[model samples]
Target: MQMHKNRPKNEKHSRTVMIRILTCIRPHTALVALSLLLSVITVVLTLYIPILTGHGVDQIIGKENVDFKELSAVIITILACIAVTSVCQWFMNHINNKITYRVVKDLRICAFNRLQVLPLSYVDSHSSGDLISRVITDIDQFSDGLLLGFTQLFTGVITIVGTILFMLSINPYITLVVVVLSPLSFLIANFISKRTFAMFKKQSEARGELTGFTNEMLGGIKVVQAFGHQDEAQEQFEEINRRLSGYSMRATFFSSITNPATRFMYSVIYAGVAIAGCFAVVRGMLTVGQLSSFLSYTSQYTKPFNDITGVITEFQNSLASAARVFELIDQPSIAEDKAGAVRLQNPEGHVTMEHVSFSYVPEVPLIENLNLEAGCGQRIAIVGPTGCGKTTLINLLMRFYDVNSGIITVDGQNITDITRHSLRAAYGMVLQETWLKAASIRDNIAYGRPNASEDDIIRAAKEAHAHSFIMRMPDGYDTVIAEGGSNLSQGQKQLLCIARVMLCLPPMLILDEATSSIDTMTEIRIQKAFEKMMEGRTSFVVAHRLSTIKSADMILVMDKGHIIEQGVHEELLKKGGFYARLYNSQFSAV
Candidate 1:
């Protein structure tokens, strides 16, 4: 009952996905038309061969009656037709491959570009493995299905139509027998395909789930081993993998029924046509040569049905994968810059947040009515416990996430009114979670200022205290960083990130535990270098190590998303309030 109920919905979804896939092929309309034309030529030439063979048979009634001259001409003409058909089929396949791959390439580029503009929140909520599966694995499956459809579908239809016409001309009674039995094959195929589509959809989703689970475990394998949870992680992975296998088996089972079921019906049609044609020949209504041609036409007519039915599994999987891909590309992108939005130019490094309210989830409040100001060239330090909205504040300032109810401005201009590119360009940032591309150390340092001179890059590296370690490597400045910087120590990676920011020297700075990985001595040296860099730029530093921020022009003590206390180092210590207690707790041992 449930299977019957879902048939209409499944059919509708399949239709929609196919329509979208066709739109991708629209740019190659000329190729498609050419393919159709070639299909007609190929089918017509191939179908004509059987007629020539029948005629050749008629010419050789017996040894004494045989016409060798006519028989030789028919044989040559048959060979010519076969040769032309093969050439046309080859050309048709080449065009299909070209169109299919081009569409797949376009889809991949669109998905990747969509990722660039997707809001950070969406990335936070979706698993990276699932996204990767859609882009890579699913697209490859779609390409295979599309190529098969193009290769088989055009010629299949033409052959079926051409064979039916040729058969009707040969013997109407045998053709009628073939046509009557053909519908049963289609009915059987239709029933199985409807069920298979739903199964394949579930299978695709399970594959994505398994991918996400595997990715999560691998990314955190170190943590899992350190905590002695290898058994638990493996058990969870096995569970997801088992589920995926079950879905795949069920989808395959249903789809596999389609081909054999249709073939059985096609065999019956062939038997029926053969019997009817033999009776007609016995009744003097058909010739022996004509009966042979009718039999060949019957096989040709049913071959298309068998071929189309055989590809139903692949076609369903492709449609399922296409749905997932389209879903991602259609997701609402991040807000675009407003009309006539101004670009932030020569920013004065004065930033202000007024009455800002924000929450990652609506029911759970995080930050509320937050107000703060940083004067030009002032260094403001933000200190708070974990999950106390310290990073969220920085996100708001940089427009990574917009505030719900209030405005954040840079140099008195609302950040929302400024183009995000130019607004973010005004600040240099180094966060605790460092990111480095797989490129030379020189390129990593010059990431922010790609055109910076070699001397400038070396100076920034020296300032970040990374030059000495870099020089020891085999390629010095040209040493290529590995993917994820696995070849470098955590401290070395952080240093390169800092050097990147140093090279930029933007008007504003954000340091979120920027020096946390380095040892105390190097951190002290880097802090001194940071001081020189911040001499004339407003800097916002979020740190858990309170000792590093003592010289900040103003210190903000935050708790529960509000500023509980704000003062200079001397004044905050004298007051013995939240700021004093936090400061004392860190340096009390000293």
Candidate 2:
């Protein structure tokens, strides 16, 4: 289950998310300040047009002949205001976009930087597709909504205030009438907005699930086709895709209705104000020009209701994206390093585990009270059936995971007492599953030892039996591999990984089925190289092929998270225990 499962579905959470967004915006203070100042100028200039038009109307009222000079001045002033308003509006949009995009870039960088420091367990538990969505898709959606909401949000506020003040100066009674009916637009918008927030949240979740499914399918496309499971995979993808479409439809439908509904109510308010103004005009209580200006003010005041309601509609989607992003940022990570931690330098690789116990979850331990030790420069080989905790032992030794009880130590000092960087740096590891990024072969080989010389990188590759195929390529060492090195064979990728570890040449080595992909003939040929690399180094080997581990200094047979047998190869066979049975079962088949 995801930690995001019990999301805070309350107003406080939404407010907090918005506060975070504001924090991002606040960093670019000059841009936002300028945008807001332009917005105010634009709105004030727009409101001035109506006031001038009202004065022109009063001048023409009850006149046998028009005052040409006054009329010309009124028209000139209105035109000048429109031109200035256009310029201010243009600058306001430019500044808003600059602030919005800069804020979005900083937010994405923060999310990516957070992932770099997060513990490995959190990465293991979460879906890759969902994290990608939060970093890429969700941030884009959230920023877009923020841009739309804020741009109109500021202008809408200023228009409302300016219109209200001008209307009050003209006639407070009519202004009050407009004010009372304003809440009707808000009421309808509130009713619709309440239903939309949850719908958008669900839609965002379904989108991430669909994205996850697509990534999984593509990454394993070869297996899916080889096993003839195409139809099954297609069915599963369609199910998730259809679910995403349904949630999107519901969210959009609710958002779409907000603008039209608010406009409908505004139109009703407009009609009522016009009728009331006519009576005032006929009774000589208000001038014709004032009535005309009052009608215009009524329209302007009511228009903001529609703009604000539209913001309410779009805010739902932004809120949904924000919640997902925060969920990832809020996941509990493994405890940080203790203050004043020690660093291990030139470790002798004297590893020991005493009463160590651990589990992926509590109450059902995977390794319980297991005790083990390996002297400096001893080669330890661990053999077991699937799920017998062979790999779990190595994980504990490296402190990839901390043991629930008991301690693991190196060179007589507790592993936890050392800085993680210094602790992990002591061991050179090569796993069964190879990892290669989109970089030159030489760069990948020298990843750990970045300052390694060209001659040393080639020497390591030659020892690992990877030099011939690499040289056959047109670009040789400079050839860039695609992500995952899809063009390379399984054995080739594994050999490259081995070459990487050999180049680093750390104090200790861990080979987890390291060369399982190589053929028996190839393995026999590379045995000399393996012997050379493991010389005088504490090496732990986890191999399914019993032949590869026959010469280990110490052989451990594990079953159900316990050490079932321990001895040299000949002695273990003499006992005819779990180790003997496992070894004989493999050779007998051959």
Candidate 3:
């Protein structure tokens, strides 16, 4: 498995980002085209008003008196134009919002589905909070940005093009002034966009960090309060929040300057065109009606500059968000079951690991040249000190990770050749740490075998000695558990987890310090339950408590990834080797 110590940087090209975003919109092409067409129609109606007003002033108004008829006609025409423009604008927004949200929805779903199939190694190394932020927070930002960008960019382009044509028809000199000042707006937008993009990227990252820290702290809130870390946690969160606020302010500060800077240029050119128009009228080079029309057209032409710049300024933030979502989607998934892979059906539960070698990191080998065999219904107990590759071996057996070399086989068939679904289904596991959902006791127990009958679920709970305590809850099996099963004691949570595995009824079982959280009294009941459950199933019991595994058919004593001794407890103690020493030391400490 490839592991990255550092998070990947958002380095997607702007063109790549735009293309991906466009591709998302491509599915709703017909709706998008209609929205753009409405934008054009809206612009046309708007431009028509200026034309009718210009004509009324030039031909119908007398110098000494106002022409109410022509003025009324122009006013009526402008009002009609506004009514149609508003309707078109509303419908266009409706379409754009639909298209934008649909695209973001699809993006979020794809990213989430990808997470389900991603390698456990990657999931393990990454922060859940940051991943959640990317899935929810970043995608929402992308949608907002896209919606705004689409509305502005579409109308901005059409408005600029239409206004320029009208202004040129009235007077080219005034149009020239607008054209010349236009680049300054873009230049300012361009400069500010580059700076804001970087600032906002950092801001998004800071938000993710803050989110990750909060999630981590909340998940372990009990420990935090147990040690009185409330103030420390608050202070740390404030530091991150403060840093995020600074980035946010800086990004806002840079982006906020864009509109005002462009509008300042617009103001300069607006006055310049009006002043130059006055001179033109006095020189008889342009008429009063024409100059008036030209001034109106100049404002229209320059208004797009404001919008386009504003869109450009805000678009950078969306681009930053898009880059984050796409980066997550682009990670490689774990290899699927091989072609022609066989399903692991009912078996006698013979398992073997031949010449197995593995390392979490390439430079550091944790297990080397390991070989093991267990026949059907054999009970193998694996005992070792911490970090001795005990759990790592179990991880391989479950195919959570593949070995660096050699073969893991069941019933003489290589596990790699078995469909992972069926291969994993053959084994039931109860781990050291119990994980329960915020669900009812029944649902939590049924999680292992969703189709299990109610009687079976209850039976499994009874076998794990959880049914009596469960009945005392307000709703018995229907009683809802809190997150991480916090509503139940640690032993109660473990019992539910064990009940879950018991319901699976697989040919093989894994008890990886499964009773670690249970008190001595409950542990005795659970161990008895394990005996009945493992009657005809091969079981690998990983435990530190030597007493628990004293009756295991074969005890494999391990140190530094190598099994140094194998026998029943008495035989191993009689050898007086490393296993004997460990047993003595563990007992002496107790």
Best by TM-score: 1
Worst 10 residues of 1 by lDDT: 305-314
Q: Across residues 221-275, which tens digit of lDDT does each residue of candidate 3 receive?
A: 9899999999999999999999999999999999999988988998988998998
Model 2 off-target regions past 4 Å?
A: 1-9, 56-68, 285-292
Candidate 1 — which pairs collide? none
TM-score computed on alpha carbons, candidate 2: 0.93
How does each model score on lDDT?
Answer: 0.91, 0.87, 0.89
The alpha-carbon deviation from the true structure for residue 306 of candidate 2, after best TM-score superposition, in angstroms, is: 2.0
Q: Which regions in candidate 3 have their CA more than 4 angstroms from the true location?
A: 1-12, 55-66, 230-239, 285-287
Better of 1 and 2 by TM-score: 1
- Candidate 1, residues 471-570, lDDT tens digits: the string is 9999999999998898899999999999999999999999999999999999999999999989899999999998888999999999989998898889
Q: Give lDDT for model 3.
A: 0.89
Residue 165 alpha-carbon offset, candidate 2, angstroms = 1.3
